[model samples]
Target: MSILFGVVFFILGSLIVYVFQKKIFKGITEEDVVCEVVQKAFIRVKNSEHNEHKLVRELLKSDAFIKDLSLTAKFQGSIVGYILFTKIKVGEETLLALAPLAVLPKYQKKGIGKSLIEKGHKVAKNLGYKGVVLLGDPGYYKKFGYSSASKWGIKSPVKIADENFMAIELYPDSLIDIKGVVQYPKEFGI
Candidate 1:
């Protein structure tokens, strides 16, 4: 009986590690643009029935979707994390906005979101985008080099805390003279 119990315990422990290995060593890439798979993953992560699900669906359909930077982070052949970067018009200038970043609830706080964001910035910069703006927790986003939009004289169209609306110039001084109310596409419903 003792030997049998030991074998069972070992098997269970191995299974747990195997499951989490995918979460830890997932691959981040821009190749996957399957909007349907991404939309389903967003719904599962948010788990708010249909409303939250519909939001992702609409964003995927929006004209703002930048096919190049809408990235998916896959674990074991499944998309466990996703980040969408869209073009926004700030006065006559255009820049990217990181919106609707979603990671599986089970996968949050494990660096999947961070990896996606970092990878998105690298790709966006390579594609000649000047900067990126996002409405998110300053504490969380600041780690990625984001600063207050107000520092650059930029503002969000919707009224929100100054800190929550952040921007990062992909290259130094990219936002120096680019200042205006950041205008999101109408699909955002704001």
Candidate 2:
């Protein structure tokens, strides 16, 4: 029975690691995989220009791109998810913009998106970034502690629902006194 239990434990450990595999996104070589995941993830969104993959490509070449904050999740060594945090300006301070977070459709709802987000937040905090902003679902992002940007006096550069525009400070009160319209890279065209 002990041997059987040991075997079960080992199998479970391997499965966890396999499903949660993540790493810094290597450039160019892995671009296609990342783009594919982005497009696939947004395919079902109503009127999703479906050009998020293009945005990812553009962000990669933009000055705002942070190489260290771009991450990928893998399954069995194949890239299955991607997330990017790019530099954005709020007032005079530089924070982050979380964009194009994507997971292959088949891989959705399995904690992969949450894992990428938590991992990105950790890396951003380690890199000294105080906060991040994004345009996304209120309910989904709220799970990660994202709240209305308006609460921090931050406004959206474009006209957007207050709830859809959100921000999260990496640490307590990190976004205090940070108030302004978020300036996304021109690549965003917004």
Candidate 3:
């Protein structure tokens, strides 16, 4: 039908216009912008904390904060995406935890989140991190190399589905010997 053909063209058009800037998040100076991005990104999620901006504020002040792993994606001089990977405890090893990755509602999909994750992984690998863990949609995260945490004996303190609680090694065999319940920072209130 003509309507179906029109829908296809619209989808392709949106993808063609998707582009953004990504860089190490400027701490303190850009905190409010990042908070605002987080707010708008999750405005429709029924189970979202709905106050994730507050969590980001607390995490920034926590010892787990990692300046280099904090990244933002900007489009046309305005921040449109943000991703924070903080330090977390896994038995004796210290790994990164990716949380609250946000992309503005209007900008969702179109590879913004994908690019941010790829960049974060590269930076994390260079920083000598073993891997990154997160609770997110497995279908999406898996496309970026994430797998069930249980595959490496990693468990979450809070109950969650195996598929939703996922992780990705930064490099080959990085998590081969690591295994334990993740100890999130106090800021997470877990």
**Candidate 3 or 1, higher lDDT:** 3
In order of lDDT, best first, we have: 2, 3, 1
Tell me the tens digit of each residue's lDDT in model 1 across 75-146: 888778878898899999989888767777677889999999999999999999999999888899999999
**Ten contiguous residues with the weakest lDDT in model 1:** 28-37
* Tens digit per residue, CA lDDT, model 3, 27-50: 446899899999999889888879
Decoy 1 TM-score against native: 0.74
Q: Candidate 2 lDDT (Cα, whole model)?
A: 0.93
What C-alpha lDDT values do all the predictions have? 0.81, 0.93, 0.91
For each candidate, what TM-score against the reference?
0.74, 0.84, 0.84
Cα lDDT tens digits for candidate 2, 142-161: 99999999999999988899
Q: Model 1, 41: alpha-carbon shift in Å?
A: 8.4
Candidate 1: what lDDT?
Answer: 0.81
Question: Comparing candidate 1 with candidate 3, which one achieves the higher TM-score?
Answer: 3
Off by over 4 Å in 1: 1-52
